[model samples]
Target: MPGLTFEKLLLIAIIAVFVLGPEKLPHYAAQLARLVKSLKNMASGAKDRLRDEMGPEFNDVDWQKLDPRQYDPRRIIREALLDDEGAAAPVAVKPPTRSRPVESAAQKRLGLAEAGAAAPFDSEAT
Candidate 1:
């Protein structure tokens, strides 16, 4: 029912008319109808076969109960953050990193300040 529309039927008819010509178009159209019917019957048969194979377990499936669009990221993140904050155990707090010692002007001027020290001033006189 979903796929059966007037436009689609018209398109199929046009294609059939083109490929089968006006003379044999009726025969080919009949064959096409029979093929479509057989396909539908095969699909229905497969569904019934699958249900039978699944046995009594098939009845337990609640297809309408699942709604995949219910996920909420904000709620999940809020709950996780709250849970971490509310934990009873005292978490080890990392000590504030010792502030990097400021280099004196003398040390900065001299290249011997540190092994990886960058030359602060550009000196083109080599």
Candidate 2:
């Protein structure tokens, strides 16, 4: 079904005719059809057996949710980390407070001002 298009199937048929010859082609084709039919019947029979063993619960089962391919690692981790209620509570934060300004090393070396005092301006430096 995936890769067997009409063109590819036609090519295969042509090749088979050349290899197997016209005389034996019909016999082989009938055998192949029978094999495919038997395989389908086996698969359906297995499904029916499983359904009988499972009883009415088989129809109630969520097939899509149970599928392994639908699972996501990130979502599983997130769910595991969450509370039983599912929603996360909001956190409270404190407002920032103003602090004293820092003094520069030049101001300390010049000895022009105290450690926390503002520096005096020099007109030439500008």
TM-score of every candidate relative to the true structure: 0.42, 0.52
Backbone clashes in model 1:
0
Return the clash pairs for model 1, or none: none
In lDDT terms, how accurate is model 1?
Answer: 0.80
Estimate the TM-score for candidate 2: 0.52
lDDT of each: 0.80, 0.85
Over 4 Å off, model 1: 1-5, 64-126
- Candidate 2 backbone overlaps, count: 0
Q: In model 2, where do residues sit more than 4 Å from their true spots? A: 67-126
Q: What is the lDDT of residue 108 in candidate 2?
A: 64
- Please, what are the lDDT tens digits per residue for candidate 1 over residues 25-84? 888778879999999999999989989999988889887655655557898787887789
Which window of 10 residues has the lowest lDDT sum in candidate 1?
111-120
